[model samples]
Target: MTRTPQCPGCGREDRLQAVPAVYLGGRDTVRVRVRNPDDHHDRTVDRPVTTALSEALAPVPEPPSRAIGCLGVLALLVAVGTFAAGAGAGHWLDDVPVVEGGGVFDENGIFHAPGQELPTAGPAWPDFAWLAVISALALTAAVLVLVLRIRSRRAFTRLTSGRAQAERLWSRAWYCHRCGTVHFRDAPGEDTRPLTFQEFRERVWQEGGYGDLAATQRALGGVLSIRPGQ
Candidate 1:
């Protein structure tokens, strides 16, 4: 026979329920009436207790790989634009004839050439070549950013592998409605002071190895620490 769960705070077995069960039981549904049957809707409402439990048990969000990837993509677009501009300028410059002094005069009468002796006021072939080189460097940087993003995503996946075990631990937690405290079923009898929701959740996650994972992520730095709200 299964023994009834007793609340550590009130020493009563009558009002104790599993945390997950309490959360589920505290939810209410409201049906909205509409003229059309297809437009009818049912909305789930969570009681205050249920909302608190849900927030406490919510999963840690993944690292901001998507935002980093967007930066990589923006860099790639800039590289492409610069490359196209450089190539177009080079092609246009190739058609222009060099004057007798190895320099060409622009419509504004500014002279440009490959050497230091000539005036460098107008666009020239060498300028476009340097632009192409800069574009190539930018492209390389963008590629590196994208690769790092992929690696960070993979690392986050590996780090969160123990989340299921943490959730299992959470499922076994008990809530005392009378005193508003939570505790695990196997909690020590001597340490019967019930934990707050946050404390309970943290203990569960720590026992499930998620605490180390969080620490490791923090050590890794960069986008790993980029969680929402902080």
Candidate 2:
């Protein structure tokens, strides 16, 4: 069974109901559904986002991948550069043995003194090689953080209409909530995609639900007027 978890954003006992799953594409938010207790009205409506604090708690969508790709490239370049610095320090700065093994004590090879090991150890590499590695990695981290911040900012604007969609939704849901009056103009959108009552609650509530859950309870109260507690 699709049991609902209380919304972490709102701290309500309501859960995700099937039939009409919430649609979350317009503003790049991970939107979800909320509903009245045990009420199953098969109508969908958009809700304004009321609780700024609660809305802040909702999941933000991922930033565009191009920004992420650039960050990865920066990280890879840093890794390669650091590795090269270490390799160069070890190979060029340090002295390797001239002879493969103790062949002969001659000009072509270095003669080891009595009771000595082959390929004698040399001076340790400079500490500056390690500093190069650290510096490169730090630059990569800074670049990635900047890109993420920019992308997230752009995504935030998409949730609210650019004044156009709002005009449309307002034109559509143009009925008095206090009374059971209907709108003069027909809701423009087609019933193209039929949603369950639970899904309907989630989609419309994305905008308006957080302001006052009590207001929602009141709006729904009319539908559920028969029940004593409703």
Candidate 3:
């Protein structure tokens, strides 16, 4: 009941396979990966989900959140200020005595006023050092938060092109050549369909969005590696 195609390279039906891949996020393109078990040749091709394909195809874009970025920067500044204040306190404490009762000082070391009792000795080191350590930890956490916030903002604000969107919509697939040129099939038992690179240059110019295919390609390229291939 099912008809299968043979591999063009080896003329064998068992050596060819077609796999179908789909992306459900935004785009509606199907990608077919064609493979030949004999020679190990592999190729991936994209096709529109619908018969009428647009030149400028893209997914919905998410808006940027400036508020989050501002908040992150504010947090970072506050952390730095806290650390600086702690450091200043430590420096100021350096001049004060750390004896049991906290002694007083004059130009020549310990001061003994006329009939004044000397203060009790205090701890050897000032407690300001603890403040500095805590502040340093807070600053480190703030820096980490700031970095994450900036990365998230860039992700939301970055532009995605039509071509890249189209690629996202493509389905994963496999294929093998039959007699003439290469043909694609969803599975070994399914009927074969002709697969070829669909150029959107003329259609892009006529439809609306991009002026040419090159423009579409450029627009699809992203500044970050996380986005789809351009």
Quick one: best TM-score, which candidate? 1
Judged by lDDT relative to the true structure, which candidate is superior, 2 or 3? 3
What is the overall TM-score of model 1 with all chains considered together?
0.52
lDDT of 3 by residue, 30-93 (tens): 8998887888999788875622112122222224556766665676677677667766755534
lDDT of 1 by residue, 1-230 (tens): 99877777778877777877765764455555334456566554433332434444443433554777888888898899988898787763444443456667667777777453443355566767877877888899899998998888887777677778777776777866666677777644324467765566556667556675344333122123223222
lDDT of 2 by residue, 1-230 (tens): 93443322233333322211111212233344665556854444465432321221222222245666566567767776766776676554454554444454645467666444445444445555674666567566757666765766565455433334333433333222222222212445423233322233333444332222323322332233222111
Q: How accurate is candidate 2 locally (lDDT)?
A: 0.40
| TM-score winner between candidates 2 and 3 | 3
User: Which of the predicted structures, 1 or 3, would earn the higher TM-score when compared with the native?
Assistant: 1
Model 1: pairs clashing at backbone N, Cα or C within 3 Å? none
Give the CA lDDT, 0 to 100, for residue 157 in model 1: 77
Find the 10 residues in a row with the least total lDDT in model 2: 17-26
RMSD of each: 11.7, 18.0, 15.7
Name the regions of candidate 1 deviating beyond 4 angstroms. 1-55, 59-61, 92-124, 174-181, 186-193, 213-230
TM-score of each: 0.52, 0.27, 0.29
lDDT of each: 0.63, 0.40, 0.43
Q: What is the lDDT of residue 199 in candidate 2?
A: 30
